[model samples]
Target: MAGEELKPSTVISLADAMQAYSAGRYAEAEDIGCRIAAVHPNDPAVWNLLGVVARMTGRQPEAVACYRRGIAVAPDYAALWSNLGNALKDLKRCEAAIVCHRRALELEPDVATSLHNLGVALTAAGRDGEALHAYDAALAIEPANENVIWDRALSRLRLGDYAGGWQDYEARFGRDELPKRDLPGMRWNGGPYAGKTLLVAAEQGLGDGIWVARYLKRVKALGGEMIVECREPSRALLASMGVADRIILQGEPLPAVDFHIPQCSLPGVFTPDEAAIPTEPYITADPQERARLAPIIAAAAGERLKVGIVWGGSGTYASRADRDAKLAYFLAHFNIPGVQLFSLQKGPQEEELKALPAAPVVHLTPHTADMFETAAAVAELDLVIMTDTSVAHLAGALGKPVWVLLCRVPHWMWQYGRSDCAWYPSMRLFRQRTWGDWTGAFDEAAAALQMLVLQRSGKLLTV
Candidate 1:
């Protein structure tokens, strides 16, 4: 009813634009939407479509402008308000987005999208309990909403309800964002695959692959041959650690297997209880690789205590920006008298090292290309100080002493409020006392690092 009374040419153009957007031709849709907006400046529908296309194309600011323009034209449009809220949420304006979502809900009380958006905003604002209630209300309206179900899973897990959490987490497989694998076998249902091959396909990030590989040994002991499918970067390291009987890269042609399971689902099958989590390091560096890199690292260290530092994770990660610590923070805080810091950071964030603040921390990331090399380099280090990144998982997997700086509400794997990680014996968690407050975490880490440095230098006896 919104754009129905327009001219015939305008109607056809609007239809074309909507079809293009629905078909995933965002660029074409954006061009058409802009043309329509220019010709019919009063049409809120055209502006709304432009906003959607802009948001889909990673133009959040443009999307916000378009949504604002649409709101100006049709101030009472509930859909426009909800859409604007989503864009604002993406821009990390959680409180403002929440306000928009609430206004949308006031206009259209039964709108599931508004409810779901409200849930997401609340979750980002660290109100997970209220977020769950919002999600529940949305689910009541639309029971099979995958997005709401997946988000609800995260909220449940954050609250430390593993039993309730894992069940809902299964909804992630159906979410469109995650790449789905279509293997030619039955899904593993926590049963023994005696004398058969079980393909453990990789899902999610490289760190998740390494984290879940711990359960592969258990899968092996179940009287079955296990084939672990992982990313190319992880294959060598995981193979070296003997995570499975056979290791294969993700894009390789699948070998015949009786059943298959995603790596992330391992926790649901094996260790559902938090207390029963395996603490021993299941991944180890190759002996030859470790031997080869040990001298190179020692020479770089000279006479000081070697500490590997990773200030950032992959930028593609959803929470990378949130998890990242300022390189300057580490440079200023980690200046222990007898300690020599080495950067284990890689990717685009590596460029930040050029601005190192008078601290002579060596950058070892160039020497470590893949996880195998990272594990080898980590093995040679005295300690690792890192944010919530793959390097932390790698250091922990190698049984190296790692101090992991966590966000106030860290990933579900870290669990609720414990300083020591149950999965990695050598890893210590430094959590933020307040949300988005890395300073407090850094202060605690600095004190612990000072004690460690003193112990290393024989100035203190206890660690």
Candidate 2:
């Protein structure tokens, strides 16, 4: 004991580093991980902890490198392989991620996490059938896994299994990221609401609210006075739709109601048959707002067909990078001789429009006031062309001719393998033939637009 020395301050054990990570002290975890990696370079556990810390801190490239190092040290380590797969999936390298996940499963079969990760990668790669199987396998192992349930629901919805999908979709309310609302009223259970006031609470994104608001009319018909709550930006737009007897902004004190339902839950409750799904638009802009914007848009368009274009949605969306197309693609493709394209895009991505070469495109996003104002502007347009975004839903809800450019695997509402949306009769969908192939979608859209222009000019009878 006379010559014995205590370990250096920089020395850290794998257990200590993991404890720091579990406590959410990511910076400390990263420091400890780096120290451990330096001294015990060949230790797979040290490299794995370093990778997890890097990923948690948004250093995905570093995470990938660390995971690879860990795999090199311990090739048969299933957890290391699975972690690498998750990092690759986050980077949108789904094919590579799928390989990693499969290798992880090969090393250790019957791992629920590996199965779930494999499902996610498969789904992102546009292999919904395989993803569904992976999810089912995961569910078999751990029946109450919320993440797996949610992913399986999305896979089901993508395959157009609405009945089962919507039921599993309820798991979102249980997810920590989307906390369940603690409202005063009783949660509605599809019971008769005759003579009872019902409050429909908003959930998820504005686009989700717009999409599900269609169900309000059905709720209104169920013989109840309905009150709808929405975000402030959407309050004016939802109010104009006239689907509810009263509309309130989120966070406001609510009036007494006999029953309440999250807006998304309406589908599960109503279970509208495929044929019963509403095809007509349920929302419109104020005529005064439309009248006000029509002349302004008409002056900009002259005699050319006015086409409103939105190339992106909110940048904060997890999948926006995949769903959004370059603004240049629209400028290059929508250059038909007799058509004028107006930029209906909002948010930070609108800056990209300024970099485009001189074209017959008018920027209207600057003048748009709110979602209602956007609806007013969309109403003035002869056609609206947009990627998956709120504007697409707004244009469709206003009953305007809208062409939606879709990613290879689009949102659940769009379904799959269809050029027409059941939710919006006036909407036409142009899907990517391959993943991330916006050019193909744009080319098809251009051809459709040419036909639309001919139809408008009386050269073609129908489009």
Candidate 3:
């Protein structure tokens, strides 16, 4: 041996712990770490490693405890503080988590990762401006930090800083962590469409397609030949944006063009600000589609005023996908007397509607041919109420009379702490004050519908 020394038993155990952790043997890692911790109670590294293992294994409380123990042992480890903050955030202790992140940033400023985490915690706490600053701080150190830039853009959007937000919103494409687009066999760079035609395809969820399809009009305004390739659910709606030169299902073939842009890239290309929101509902039911569905809607809508309702969206979230509002959940608590209800809901929820008391209501969801058909049906309605679904986006995009019911932690488009959606001038938001409790939202919706009903009858009720 170059240097004669006794190998520390605790250090050996720690090395074993690291190996186990790296091998994905979480239980083995936990045991090895605990053994070292028992022998070297003063070693903060052991505790920190244990915390990481705990966090990895979904024992968030244990992770928090381990982090705290590490911090107590060595209060100066900025990384330990940051890890603790992340654990607290997983526990929904956002305020405490931000404090820990801030402390870590203070002790070692300009750390990009911690700064990004700090922005996330701030945004979760509904502190948008501070979150924006945190993200900006991270960007100041690493300008192309994609996630930080994305967060900053969202924060800008929520604060109604339209120009800056849309300008930055373009950063989402081709980034790591974003879903890979299933190229419908062709792609383009969005070059001038003067003599060339490009097929703009949609790569994300239907809501995204709906929101960004507003840019298709800009493309049309640019005097280019363009066709919108969208999710099957969005064909009609995209067609109605008054811009797409053609509308087809995702992956459908189209006339060649100079370049192509994803539907969601419209904001990036058009630089949409509040002034450029394309607020008017340009998509609607064509005369034939409306006429075809008139009998069905009329029969279902009957003497009572019709309210097309959807309380959930297609699953686009990773965590808590199960929290989607089931129509039965809301209907169980609802007893709207004069408001004849129709379920404009699509996908899996349509199957469940067969079990509800819908004799007074109608379900034309399955019959809808496209977004245009849906919009036509929606246009026939006195109002549309829905969960954070593409239906909401369509109604909102169309500037139809829409009432959106959102989960407490809704999609970013609703913006932070918002009761109104600027994207759709006629849309109103009713958010869950607490997660999974639609009672409050339903109560508000019921009241609003009552007011709407009263208004229809020439009675003005003050809110």
Of the candidates shown, which would achieve the greatest TM-score relative to the real structure?
A: 2
Candidate order, lDDT descending: 2, 1, 3
- Please, what are the lDDT tens digits per residue for candidate 1 over residues 103-136? 9999999778889999998887777899998999
lDDT of 2 by residue, 1-463 (tens): 1112213543335667778899999987777777666666788887888899899889999999999999998999999999999999888788999999999999999999999999999998889989999999999999999989999999988787878888889888778768877876898887778999999998888888998888888788886788998997798988887678999888899888889999988877766446667767888788998888888899989988999999999876778888999888987888787899898888888778776677568998777878988889998889999899998888888789999999978998888788998888899999997777788899999998998889888899976
Q: List clashing residue pairs in candidate 2.
A: none
Q: For every model shown, what is its TM-score relative to the native structure?
A: 0.86, 0.92, 0.82
For model 2, state the Cα shift of residue 23 in Å. Answer: 3.6
Q: Which has the higher lDDT value, candidate number 2 or candidate number 3?
A: 2
Task: Show model 2 residue runs off by greater than 4 Å.
Answer: 1-12, 354-359, 454-463
lDDT of each: 0.85, 0.86, 0.75
Candidate 1, superposed: residue stretches over 4 Å from native: 1-17, 23-43, 69-75, 325-329, 354-359, 407-409, 415-418, 431-440, 455-463
Give the C-alpha lDDT of model 1: 0.85
Global Cα lDDT for candidate 3: 0.75
Give the per-residue lDDT of model 3 (tens digit) for 270-295.
55456656677656667887888878
Model 1 scores worst on lDDT over the 10 consecutive residues at: 1-10
Residue 7 miss distance in model 3 (angstroms): 11
